[model samples]
Target: MYKLSPFTYTFAGRSKAKKIFLDSTLIFERNDTVAIIGPSGGGKSTFLKILKGIIPEYSSGKLEGEVLFNGHPLSGVYFQENLQKILYLFQNPFSQLIYPGTEEEFLFSMENFNFTREQMDREKEKFEKLFNLKNIWGKKTSELSNGECQKLVLASMLAIGPDVLLLDEPTAFLDPTARKEFYQYLDVIRKDRLLIIVDHHVDEIRPLINKVIFVDHDGHITPGFFTKNNFVVEDISLPKPKTAEEVNVTVSDLSFSYHKDRELLKEANATFKSGEVVAVRGRNGEGKSTFFKLLSGILKPKKGQILLEKNGKTYKNDKIFPHVGFVFQNPEAHFFFDTIEEELKQSFRFLSKEHTVLKDDLLSRFFHDIDLKKSPFLLSEGEKRRLSILMTVFLEKSLILYDEPTFGQDQKSIEEIIVLIRELKKLGLIQVFISHDDYLIEKIADRVLVLEAGRLYEVPRA
Candidate 1:
């Protein structure tokens, strides 16, 4: 059995260090299937770090607690020695990946543990079949989509056969079908191992979890059942599509590929009109994010043209960057400045004082509990995502591309994003986003574009 005695953790350095866990105690037994659920920025990820022996060791923090592994006190040395036994499935899959190729990542732990060739082969084959990773085999980790990356890392962890598995938002990037398959796979293999998952998609994972741990905003963690009233979500209206002929984006005969054998996009053509919110949908590794990057001028297409037109003037390639605002899927990669205040100042520099005040008010709504003086990197994933969105909106660009804008958001935060998108649409900006969230697509997208097998198809709706 693994147990965490009563403990408190305070983030270090700041004059007002934030307390993440206040005298929280939790226990886990073999084969215990537990789900950790809470609002955004409620210390779920932090708690997982503590369990993995990362807090106060790699990260500076004031921690007072006893974490035991099988009745023995867990120390850095002990944790290092037993790395294969206690595995952590990270929230950002890219953060944990070091190898260039997926196959190398799969064999890394096994090689370290000195597994026999036959044993490694057997375990790899089993996990590959379970994860449906044949298509992405031998591919570079950078080439895979976020969902594909998640699957690769997860399959690698399963190959190790850990006694305890810690997953943080394991399905945040996967499509509906892949998400179902992933949970089913977990349910099948969860007999002897202890599974602790931190996710916001409660309904989808409910059947797989026997116990639920709720972490509240007040730094309290306790056993609880799934409840909708845990968050106060405000009702928000969807964006109203507007008519604007002078502002539009057109992609003509576009073709892109990362490798000669693998064709990501081929002769894809589409148009997004001003004030229309478009959602890009596809299976994992289908290059939906690559399409967004092409449109945003972050990547050059191998063939064809992308034209962003506003007021009868056209911008192409690098020229489009000035008018395009992009919220990357990895929110941390989008941040450059140290403090949130410094980051926001970039957006504030161009706006009038009145507009700046309005933007400040919006930021306060989304980040009420945060201190602007703190680093944006210190914010939770959800908080970082929200900050990226607000900064993008403050830019007041002609076109915006959101790559999974609602990735780590909770119900309340998702509703708030809808409100913000609606406001942007009212300003007649052209918005294109890639998301696996059906509800967000249904609520916000004026048109849905499906990318599959290197072709783009438009779904006509009434």
Candidate 2:
């Protein structure tokens, strides 16, 4: 059981200090399964850090009051004394993967905790079976997809058999089928274990969680089964494309493989037209991200060419960069500037004077609630995702690729993205996004492409 009494936390920002949790008190009973829900930058992750004693310990922050585990103070000593009984899985799973190989990453924690080789082997075998990680056993963690990394980290944490497991957006990168399987497995394993999850997918975790905690953007924390429906996504009007030239992207006989033994994509072909939103779907580690990289010239194809045709001109390979906008799956890795305002300014150089007023309107609408002076690194995962999408779309490229655009988004933020995607489609941009969010694809996709068995095929929308 865990209890927090009159806790408050604040982070030092560039221009000002941002208060996250304010004089909040909460308690979780043993064998309780709880879900924490909130908007972007609303302090859900901050709460988890505080619970794990990462606040004012690993990271600098102003803290007040105390967090107790089983009536004892949950601080630095608790981590070492508890025998790895309390585990916190970060939102970005890649950050936790220290080892290069998947198997090594799995056993790192157990080794550190002084588990015997026999015991470590047993735990690894059990989790490998449960997570179906056998196929990726010998691969490097760097080669695995985000979803794979998430699975590996979760399995390793579970392998230690923690008494209290705090998962921050555990399924943010998982595909639909994988997510369902994970939750079903969690439902079976969560009994008698104190499980606390922070996720934006409220409906998926609804059946598994008995208690809900709502953290609002204004530093108010409420514990209960509360319904919040007041935030509505407002529509914004964007100008049409300056030129009427038709644009399309064609992938011809594309073949790519990271290793020689296995072929990830082979003879994959797809054509996306302007004024349309196309969604790519596939299982995790099925090369969806690899295909995007090939499209963006980040990686070269083994035996094919990607061509962008627009306005009686053709651009090939790296030459297509100017006409293409990409929102990477990991937003933090793509950010080069210190602050949100600096990031936006970098994107502004690509805009035309005619679109200056439009950009102002967008800035007012999208960032009015957020502090631009704050470092983008200081923002929550969801906030970083939103800012990345906005910055990429600012390019107004002929072709745009978004990888998991709705990864950690709340309902309102997802709706806003849907609206923005529709507006981009109206501007005659060829938008192809890879997402596990079926709702997003259903709402905006003009066509759907499924990557499987080393080929791309068009799937009819349901």
Candidate 3:
């Protein structure tokens, strides 16, 4: 059992200024499966970090509360004695994964619990089958996709057999089928353990959650009820563009391989037109992200060419880097500046004179709640994602690629992103994104492409 009495936390901000992040009293008993829901940057993740004792230890913050574990105050010794029993899965898998290879990472936590060699092997096999991670067992951490990394981390935590598992946006990167499978495994283990989840996909896990806790923008908490009838999704519609036949980018005879024996893509060809939104969907390790990287010039193809056409001219993949804007799946990968405002300014420098007005408009729209002076790295996962997308827009590139643009986003934020994508299409800008959200694909995408057998195939619309 866990309990927090009149808890409150304040994060130290720039210039010695402090902002209250959380102020609420909560409790979790054994066999309690609770879901935390709120707007983006509403202290959902912060509250979880406080519960896991990560705020003061790993981050700079002030805490004023009494946290009890097993009916006693949580001290250094008390936390250590039950460290193995309490597991916290971070929002970003790269932050928690330490081992070089997937197999080693999966076994690292189990080995800490003194499991026998034979036991560890059996556990690894079980999790590999459950999460479909056997294919990536030998892959290095850096080589895995975002979805693959998420599955590996979840499999490793489940292998540890903890009594309390705190998962932050665990299914953010998983596809539809994989997300369902994840919940199936969680259902089995949650019967005898405490499962606390912070996710934006409330509808997917509605059947499994018994109670809901809503955190608001003002650091207030209130108990809420979950009802299927209350779910409402708005339909997104964009105005037609003046011209939609202009070819934006073309990939011809593209081939790429991470290893000599395994070919991820081979002779793949596709053409994207301006004023269109393309949604890339496929299973894990199917090279969706790889294709995006090739188009964005992050990775060069082993054989073949990528051409970007704009203003009656064709540019090679490498030469068109300035014309392409890519929002990585991990927002931190796209950040380089010390403060959020500086990141926006760097992108503004690349914008044309006609689009300079968008700088202030986007800043006030996307970052109204965020502090411009604060470090971009210190924001929450959802906040980081919003800032990253805004910066990419400021660049005013001809082609924009977003990888999992809706990951860790709440309902309102997701709607706002959809509106932005629609607006981009109306402006004759090419938008290609990789996402597992069916709603996003159905509402915004002009075409859906699935990667199969090292090639791209268009899915017939229903």
The number of the candidate with the highest lDDT is 2
Ten-residue stretch with the least lDDT total in model 2: 360-369
The lDDT of model 2 is 0.84
Count of clashing pairs, candidate 2: 0
Ranking by lDDT: 2, 1, 3
By TM-score, is 1 or 2 better? 2
Q: Which stretches of candidate 3 lie over 4 Å from their true place?
A: 14-25, 227-247
**TM-score leader:** 2
- Candidate 3: worst-modelled 10 consecutive residues by lDDT: 229-238
The 0-to-1 C-alpha lDDT of every candidate, in the order given, reads: 0.84, 0.84, 0.82
**Clash number by candidate, in order:** 0, 0, 0
Pairs of colliding residues, candidate 1:
none
lDDT (0-100) at residue 458 of candidate 2?
Answer: 97
> Tens digit of lDDT per residue, candidate 2, span 434-456?
99888888999999999998999
Please give, for residues 94-166, the per-residue lDDT of candidate 3 as tens digits. 8988899888999999888899999998998898789998789789999999889999998888887888999
